[model samples]
Target: MEKEFVVIGLGRFGGSIVRELNKLDIDVMAIDSDEARVNEYADIATHAVIADSTDETVLKSLGIRNFDHVVVAIGDNIQASILTTLILKDLGVAKVTAKAQNDYHAKVLDKIGADTVIHPERDMGRRLAHKLSNSSIMDYLELADEHSIVEIIAGPKLEGMSLLDLDLRANYGLNIIAIKRNGHITVSPDPGEYIQRGDILIVIGHDNDLGRFESKLEDN
Candidate 1:
């Protein structure tokens, strides 16, 4: 069965998600309080409507609860975002992902039964900071407050070193969950497999441990 998604708010973030979902051939309903914004996605989305999502009647009229997932991406309007998320959950929506403005907003959303709360700006800042901090780190994703998954390019130090010999888990308290080499990805690579220069290692561990590992790579 095809998954159905409803994106409330037609800002940059929400619009991008709708477009990507459309490209994947998923059914999407785009909503916004502004008529111009709704018109912009009229041809792109399965359905596009101009309605204030904070109003329960408006959401119910659209049958939003029937959708597989609903994204409350009301940019800058924290109150509206919170109310929309709460109403969706109250209506028995299967899943609700909300964008929060700050830590307090995120905490409130978490308490209100939002299935997922994302701070895109903050997350992106952290990712960029990590990339700037180390030349080898290609990307960084926060899994929790203290843990993250980082993609690091293998350098001269890592070349020809087998996973067993590196003993990443014992030595650095991190795990190489996958290795991307020449466009091929090996998930849970064999311990005997050797790492080649330019290989991308997907490692996950506590942030402190990841920092230590990056330092070791830099020294090599």
Candidate 2:
């Protein structure tokens, strides 16, 4: 089935999604109150409209509920963002993704039926802090409720140790989602597979548990 996406703001974040969706040949409608921004994506998106997304009448006229996904990317204007998301949900949009300005906005959006709330800047700051503070941690993805996925390099302490030896699940409540070694990726590697120095361990677990595991690796 073909998916249709409607982006409600044409700022950097929303515009990028629109352009990428166009590249993938997906149907995307770009909506912005600013005529200039709408014109910018007119040639790129499947459809570009100058409409006030906060206005329920405008959205209904556009048949926004018909789209498979709706992105509420309104920048700065928290009121408009909340209103638009509420209207989208009320109109029965199957999926509503909203960009939040801060934690408060995220909470409100979540409470108002936004299927997903993205607080990109704050999330990126946390990710960068983890990477900078822990050289072994190459990447981090924030998940709900203080959980995350992290990619950490296997240190000397873990050299030649197999997954069973680590017992990460029992000890740290972590699951090794994958292991990357020597440019080869192993998914759900057997417990008996030996870990080599510099192997990247992709792990998913609670944030505190992950921190403890990383600290233990650093200690040894």
Q: What are the per-residue Cα lDDT tens digits for candidate 2 across 1-220?
A: 9989999999998999999999899999999999999999999999999999989999999999999999999987999999999999999999999999998999999999999999988899999999988879999999998999999998788898989999899999999999999899999999999999999999999999999987886673
Q: Which stretches of candidate 1 lie over 4 Å from their true place?
A: none
Q: Each candidate: what lDDT?
A: 0.94, 0.94
- Any residue pairs clashing in model 2, and if so which? none
lDDT of 1 by residue, 1-220 (tens): 9889999999999999999999999999999999999999999999999999989998899998899999999997999999999999999999999999999999999999999999999999999998998999999999967999999998888899999999999998999999999999999999999989999999999999999988887783
What is the alpha-carbon lDDT for the whole of candidate 1?
0.94
RMSD of each: 1.0, 1.5
TM-score of 1: 0.97
Instruction: Give residue 16's lDDT in candidate 1 (0 to 100).
Output: 96
Give the poorly placed runs of model 2, Cα more than 4 Å off: none
Find the candidate with the highest TM-score and give its number: 1
